[model samples]
Target chain A: MDIKPIFKTLIRNPVGLVLIATQVALTLAIIVNSLFIINQRLDNISVKSGIDEDNTLMISFSSLSDSYNMENAIANDLAFLKSLPGVNSAMATNSLPLSNSGWSSGVSSQSDYKGVEIGSAFYFADETLVDTLGVDLIAGRSFRSEEISYYYLSDELEPPVCIVSADLALTLFPDLNNPEEVVGKKIWYGGVENPKFAEVIGVINDIKAPWRGWSEPIFNRVIYVPHKPIFGKFSRYVVRAENGQLDNLVKNIQTELSNFDDQRVIRPPRPFSDIREVFVRNDKGMATTLTIVIVLLLLINALGIIGLVSFWVTQRTKQIGTRRALGATKFDILTYFLTENLIITCIGVIIGSILAMALNNWLVTAFSLSKLPMSYLLGSALLLILMGMIAVCAPAMRAMNVQPAVATRSV
Target chain B: MLKMNGLSKVYRTHLVETHALREFSITVDEGEFVAVTGPSGSGKTTFLNIAGLLEEHTEGSYQLDGIELTGLSDRKRSALRNEKLGFIFQGFNLIPDLNLFDNVDVPLRYRGFSAKERKQRIETSLEQVGLASRMKHFPSELSGGQQQRVAIARALAGEPKLLLADEPTGNLDSNMARGVMELLESINANGTTIIMVTHDPELAARTRRNVHVIDGQVTDLRTVFNNDNVERTAETA
Candidate 1:
């Protein structure tokens, strides 16, 4: 009813005001940033993984002994695995989906055609590798098996052959109407003396290795060559099992390869989603750490508010007693203290909202995160008000318990 | 009218127990001015506190406006204090932060009166103390007598049935003390019963009745020569 007196009392106490300000400010900072971290993690998860994953299983053989002819062993292994039951198609390559490992090489056209030009992701696969992976051939076609002999030219000679993805084709020729127009354009690889002119005979849809979202869409460049006869022991066999027999297919493959080596290590096949999760595991860690820091800050803010209100109750003991003697009920005294705190808290939240906006700008600039959301700030302020009430309860109890006689006595 | 019967106050500690008032009894009818006089620590303050309902009595009964006080709880005592009694203290216990107007308005505020009614009462009470024009001045800005008057005006604004003054002029110079005493006399003459405690025998002589308290007991009940009222009671040997 008489708000002027209440406000006058508030102005008389500066320490309590400062404490409320600090608590609200800290709450705003932590809540806003934690919400941002959560949003960013969710955003990363929803981005497409970019390749068909349900029918794929990757098996690696990186430790075959050199005493065994490596090229013959790999060729024999690919042939044997493809012929097994429940195995529809398979490819032998250096890595599989979600492996986050790949090779990159630079490209140019003829001699002296030098600019950084284009970078290509190189995959050494057999003719059937593209079909086995179920990649969409957007333009042109997959490499033919009959052209294997010409796929590899002399070591000191040029090989006019390669395949690329449609994303790379678009990047190289954004103004062109037909992506296939540049299919035969000559691109040279390596030094000019041993330069290889590769024709972009086919274009496939884009693929993501999951760890490369930050760089993938801008530079989806790649080149594929036929598997060479001279090979190393380091290679993988990717198999697409028939429908639901992946476990059986794995057991059969493990049994089929048991005769090759005694000390072979064949890890269980992880699902595509699990593999993608491994790539985004760092996002999870970031979110968890932000969450913990936010919780700690909130707890600290709550304690600060409690300490402030306690100090306030103690300082105003005489005044509270006087108020009680002046016909104020215990509920009246409690409401007075609680309302005072709410006022201080609301003021602090207003200032803190401004402070959070400034801090959010600085954070977004430093960390390149999204802008601060207004809803997060408003929601945090409401939360601070509720927390402020809880914080004031202890001190309100003290205020209501003060005997009227205390103020009656002098000093 | 205010009445007390067999009133006593005892303060106890873990190690010692002390009696502040022993069977103290007095009665003040409407329109009477009663002055209680004693040396420091002679239970005069305790008497004033108990009469004002500011403290609880260890034993005894008190009645104001025909309402019993001994059986009432602390909350009820507070309500009675707010509704029926007003207090003025030796220290001129005006809230230092509030201006004269707001100070006088406090008791009325507790009474839950309308804002307009509080303003009217505050102005009338301040005018009675010759402080209507100084309503906006804070306690520290006024002289000692003015502060005491403001304290009296604060009590008066409540329109209490009984006014309790505890050394109301103790901190003032002679001139200010006399001025405050005269104001109390005038307020009392208007039919508001006043029970004041004073160390100055001269101020005690001016009241209609004087009660001398010593060692937690009232030793003398006397009416002096200047008035038609005269009575005496001797303590038991």
Candidate 2:
């Protein structure tokens, strides 16, 4: 296909050329960035949290009667859950992973560390909490029955011994090469004046905090204290069920646990999958919204190309018939329009690439987004070119039908 | 050389079938310049279109340089048009975006000539029309006479065996038409067969032969057709 003459023609009448090209450029910029953002949100939604998400269930309930025995009631619940056919392990705890609910505290390696140096989430549960959550404890000894105790927040008392995530262990003792070596190290939590120290009895493989990105310093840093909260009226517990029975187990557990005592009022047990959905709901919504935006932009760009090229075909009927008389085949007519549209698309993509990078830079400065990759630019450019070709096909076919006799007739 | 025997063209719709040309038989030998003159809706342009292979004849036989043109594929017709025939239209049909040189090069490109050959032919053709100095000027920048000359140059650039002109000077003033007529005569003097459709009787009188048409059929012939110069069928025309 010869492009020089077509370029000359477009240069002479650049209105349609400029309009479609500008639309293509703007569409490329916005769609490329929006695609990247959608991909990021999808990635966040799919990231792995350090727990058996599909098999775990968390349930919270508050007793309405004053006669409710927190200690005896929790024991009865654990015994009944552990004896169920599909149950793996059960424990009462203050939190679950990826639930968007959390308790945090400050920890440090130095006694003189002034402010909150290393922040970490705190999970309070009994000796079976790690096993119930199905997290791998790489270097740890299970807490003995005597060591586990009930904790009340009003006392402001700190646990003497705790298990730490490998990440938090590394941060507390940076010089240690192996995370297991820091299992017995001294760690301090609480305020500066009355700082309390706990001996790290174990080190577990990282537990993800309730957050979006795991790369943040505090998201993977956690301290698990072996204590079930003894708040007088309300309590929360987590249970792990066998793989295929999680939803059924949750349904039965709520009804069964409500029969434990007359004062007991059981809330519905929630699968951890639901908790995960709650955490990433906004990200999912954003990804869906941006996907719609990308689709709309593409449709608009394609229709713009079709509208402009169709108008050109209608305007140049005489010109096409003249070309046909001058020995151009129908195939030649189609090729001419395809090549012309390709040239216009190339110009738009080149400018759009530059605009994409500029928009990405602003995104980085304004919204803390990462840089746009080159693959997306190349891929989207090729996509737009393909779209332009498909969009121009109908008009080109219409141009091809113009009879050679039109050039001779007085019109 | 060109031949047409009882050629007919029909334009059909569901309700009406229009016969544009009927029993239009004519034969022009090598090196003969013929003028086709008729009134409006007399099928002069239709005859030129069929002879140029721009439109197909619905009936009868047509040949160019002894090769039968019926039942040939579109590709073959296009190739034949590119290699054997050239056209000049009334509108001066010079692609408005292209300059004179590029306009002349259009047909040569379809002929599959290389860049150097096309450039050389375009320069020579434009030079023949006395517009080589204005090769870079677009048609809009030229006068009606000059644009018609460029169209003639485009037709001549392919060095086609037969040149077809459909009212080539219809849009020009008298002076411009006279100048274009002189250029066509000089081109015919160089041994290129020319068939021109004209509305003016003075231009028709200038040609070596004249064929007149009315109501989709040829009605008069002013040339002496010796067997050595023309081969024709015994038909109504």
Candidate 3:
């Protein structure tokens, strides 16, 4: 078919064509940006926490009685949790991964704090912390049983040994090529005035901290110290259950702890997966909202095309009848309308691709997001074209069904 | 050549059934120019539509160039129409957005002619209508007569075997009507069959044969002049 005639027709109605094209372009820009943000959030949510998320459960409680000895209560709690049915291992720790709140301290290679200090989450647990959290040891060994010690409130006791994550170890000793070489190196944890040095006994593969946003680089920097009672008031136990035993353990663990001692207020036991869900709930909500907006945008864009095409069809009824009388078939009429819409959509898509990339660039500069890939742009262009075609189908069919006899009648 | 026997057309609704044509019949030889005259709403347009294969009849046996037309699929009928028929309307139905040349190319495009062939045919047809120099002018840019000529050029570009004109000169002044009539006569002189529906007796008298329709039926059939009689009359004049 000769598109020259169609082009001429469209040029005559420049305002209408431009409006449709602008609508398509804006729709493309909005949807592409929304998709990019949604994808980024999804990727952030899917990052590995380097913990046994499915099998681990955390129980947090505070000792309400002033006479409650934190050391004895935590020891009793750990023993009771470990003896429970289907419980693999248990340890009392200061904080749990994905808990959304934890303790953090700065670590430095020099005892005099002469250089920059790297911030890391302080994960103080007993000798069983490594096994209970399911963190893999890449080099050296975990703290020995004799190395475990109690930490009271405002106590100045320095731990004999500590374990660092692979990321933290690299940050602490950037000059060292091998991670194993930093295993025995001593690092300062507390203030410079009373510098508490603990030898790095082991290097864990990767463990995420709960102090900051997961998107930050400091998320995986963790330093584990051998402190049996992580705090004086609160006793938080990290318990690992056998396969398929999480839901049952979470349901009965509160009652079991209460039976052991009723003075402390035991919060409900929570699965690690639930805590992770709470940690990233805001991101999930943003992704869902963006997805909804994209769907609505596509629907509105499709409706715009349908409305414009239907109006054009109605306006050109006599012209369609004339073409029908001139030996143009139904398919010819349908193709003419579809091709006209395709031209408009193509123009819009071309403009929209540039607009989408520019918007993505702004997003990267403003929020530090990754650049939008070409695959998304091409995919969105194809999707918009398909949407335009679908939206034009009904109006094109209406044009196709115009009777040739209408040409004989006066308009 | 065209033939229709016992053709009937019924326009139906839930409350009424109106007969547009009943037992209508006509035939035109391959090289003959025939005019159909009727009062308003007397079914001349219905006959023209059926004869052009633009519509279906309620009851009929129609044949065009010896091929059965009734009960054919829409695709087959459209192919036949594209291959063998052309139409000119009283409204001078030139698509306003297209220029004269593009207007003439409509049927050729549907006929699947190559670009070069379509361009040649469009030029030739526009030249025949004396509008070749104004081929790039849009319909809105031309006068009424010029637009009609473009519509006629559109009809001629397909080189159809049968040309159907429904009051093709109805919208024109007398002078413009005569010019279009002369053009039709010249086209028919080249041996293309024509069936023209008109309300003017004078125009009908100029054709080789005249058929009068009334109340959805053919009421009269007469030959105004044979080819030999027309030639002799022309020579004597």
TM per candidate: 0.73, 0.94, 0.92
Q: Candidate 3 has what TM-score? A: 0.92
**What digit string (tens of lDDT, one per residue) describes model 1 on residues A1-411?**
365666666675466677777768767766776777777886665545445566677776545455655555566777777778877787666554455676565666544555445666666556885667777777777777765532222243233466666766666666667767768876677765556677778777765432453433333555666654333445566777777867787666765765655444444555455667776687788778887887787788778878877877787777666666556666777888888888888888888888888888988888676798788888878887888888789888988888766655667
Q: Write the per-residue lDDT of candidate 2 for residues B1-237, one digit (tens) a residue.
A: 899999999999999999999988888899888899889999999999899988999999999999999888888888898888889899998888888988998888777899999999999999999999999999999999999999999999999999999888899999999999999999999999999999998898778788888899986556555755753332336
> What overall lDDT, based on C-alpha atoms, would model 1 receive against the true structure?
0.74
Q: How would you class the docking of model 2?
A: medium
Residue-level error in angstroms, candidate 2, position A278 = 1.4
DockQ of each: 0.29, 0.71, 0.64
lDDT of 3 by residue, B179-218 (tens): 9999999999998899999999889888887778888988
Candidate 1 local lDDT, B29-84, one digit each (tens): 89888899988889998888888877889998888888878878776877788888
Highest DockQ, which number?
A: 2
Worst 10 residues of 2 chain A by lDDT: A209-218
Ranking by lDDT: 2, 3, 1
Error of 2 at A213 (Å): 7.0
- Give per-candidate clash totals: 2, 0, 0
